[model samples]
Target: MRLTVRHTTTYRYAPPRRAVVQSHRLTPSVFEGQQTIWWNISVPGAWTGATFRDGAGDRIETVSMLGPVEEVLVEVTGEVETQDLAGVLRGHRETVPPTAYLRTTRATHPDTGLRELSADALAGADGDPLDRAHRLSRAVAEAIAYVPGETHAHTSAAEALSLGKGVCQDHAHALIGAAIAADMPARYVTGYLFVGDEPMGEASHAWAEIHVPELGWVGFDPANRCCPDARYIRLGSGHDAQLAAPIRGLAQGVGEERLDVSVDVAEAAQSQQQ
Candidate 1:
């Protein structure tokens, strides 16, 4: 399938910051399942610097803006051809050991409740790691109702599990916690999910990727109750959401930072061969 994506994020500072610096993971991953047709990232009045691929095989670019800048807009326009790899991340190069993901962050730190949830999710399930992973994903989807606006960036997996409701990020976090509790290494993935016939999902989507001994890293979206297919585009991964955020930066002398994001992912028409 071919897809086109347009994502724009605007940041406004009330008092107009002196300077702003941002790191982006906005580029799509290079893998067997996906190919970039055309892609670009634009930030007016910003100097691009030090673009490099990280150990996780994600392209990272830096942008610096000198301000008196009240507003900054970052725009991304791209087209990609994607194939369904059954959520198995194949043909991607990365140097980081999968065991590195076993380390938990603040958002995914498992408490007693999360541990118990993991136990219950896996109880009476006699299967290999892959089968058990699916079961755990289903458990998370069932346990947490997909209710947007119920949580925030600081919300933890334990909190979301206790509430029994959250958005995709929360679901990913809770599922990551469950995977860790089961002794399976898991990480958070940030990317776009093309919800067919819709303008877009609420925002750019997030999911969990677990390292299966035989299959390597496999993507699972508990919120959607399935593995990533052609409809999904993988961007980057980290121990948790913040680490894998598409945009992370700092503004000097900011009164307050307000952000607005718009994303649209749609299937593209195939061209006829001559």
Candidate 2:
């Protein structure tokens, strides 16, 4: 499958700022399951800075805008060819150890409820690690309902589980928390999902990746109740949604920031995989 993506993010300030700096993880992952056909990122009037590959093997780039800048825009356009690997991440180079992901962030810290949930989900179920992971994903899906606008960016996994409603971010965090409770190393993934039937929408997508002995990193989307496949385009990843954010930066001056974002992911004309 081939996918084309267009993403634009704009920031407006009530009071113009003197300077702005941003770090981006907007590039697609290079792995056996996916190939980048063409990609570009642009920020008008901004000077491009250092570029390097992070420990997770995601490309990181920086940009700076100096002025009484009131508005800044970041645009990304790309095409990628992807194949279904049953959600198994293969041939992706990374220096970070799997154990590093075991560390919990504010967004994914498991509470008492989450610990119990994990225990109950795996209780008396004798199977390999893969089976256990599937069971945990199913349990999370049953616990949390995918309801947009029910939660915000700072909502933690415990809160989402207690509320029983959240979007994909919450689902991913909750699954990560549960997986860690089960003694598995899990991390958050930020990416795009191609909704083939409908017109493009404003939101991007997220999922969770767990490390198994047999499989290095396997993706699971509890909100959709399935493993990521060709329809999904893999991007950068981190311990939580905030850390894994595609864009992060700060402005020098005090300016009330207003943000607008639009994203479109669609099937390309040529299909590269069956």
Candidate 3:
């Protein structure tokens, strides 16, 4: 299946700033089950400074903003081709070795509540790795309410687990923590999900992928309680949300400055030709 994606982000500052520097990881790459046909990014008040690939092989770009800038906007548009590999990705594969996904700065220290999802909980389960992981994901989803503003990006998986409230990011992290504790290799995936009959909303989405020895990396979106389909356009993979964040940046001057962010993910309408 083919999909077209449009992601737009805007940053507004409380007070006008002198300059700004930002890093972006909004580009998608072709993987075992997906292919990128075309992708491009545009920044209204920023200029591309440099581009490189990060440790996880994600495409990264740096942008510089001019002085007295109060707002910055970035837009990404792309199309990808995807195939359903549910059957092939179901079982484990021996060829793919198990490896720990490197931790990110924010996802490091577990919050007080998140510690309960340690290896012990996973090992205690009486089932195969795949079955265990599926059960764990479902449990996390059912346990947590998809509440906004209840948790921030830095909230730990343990905290989310205990609070029983969080967005998709928290669910993904909780599932990852549980999988890792279970002695399974799991990674964080950031992307956009087609809401289908649900209401359109702000921002992209987040999910988790576990590695089965033979199946390689298989995705699970606990927030949606299903595997990713053609509507999903993967952006990057890492240990947690911070690593796959669409944007990160620093500035030279700072004094009582407030940060504001807005994100939009929409599906492109079919063209007349199509």
Can you write out model 3's per-residue Cα lDDT over 145-215, one digit (the tens) per residue? 78888999788887787889988988888877776655677778887765645763324789888876656
Q: Candidates' lDDT values, in order?
A: 0.91, 0.91, 0.70
Task: Flag regions of model 3 displaced more than 4 Å.
Answer: 87-98, 102-127, 200-203, 255-274
Give residue 214's error in model 3 in angstroms.
Answer: 1.7
lDDT of 1 by residue, 86-174 (tens): 99999999999998988999899988988998999899888688988998899999989998889999999999999999999999999
What is the C-alpha lDDT profile of model 2 across 151-212, one tens digit per residue? 99999999999999998999999999999998899999999998766432223899999998
Model 2: which ten-residue window has the lowest total lDDT? 194-203
How much does candidate 2 score in TM-score? 0.96
Model 1, residue 4: distance off in Å is 0.3
- TM-score for each of the candidates: 0.96, 0.96, 0.81
Question: Candidate 1, TM-score vs. the true structure?
Answer: 0.96
| Count of clashing pairs, candidate 2 | 0
Pairs that collide, model 1: none
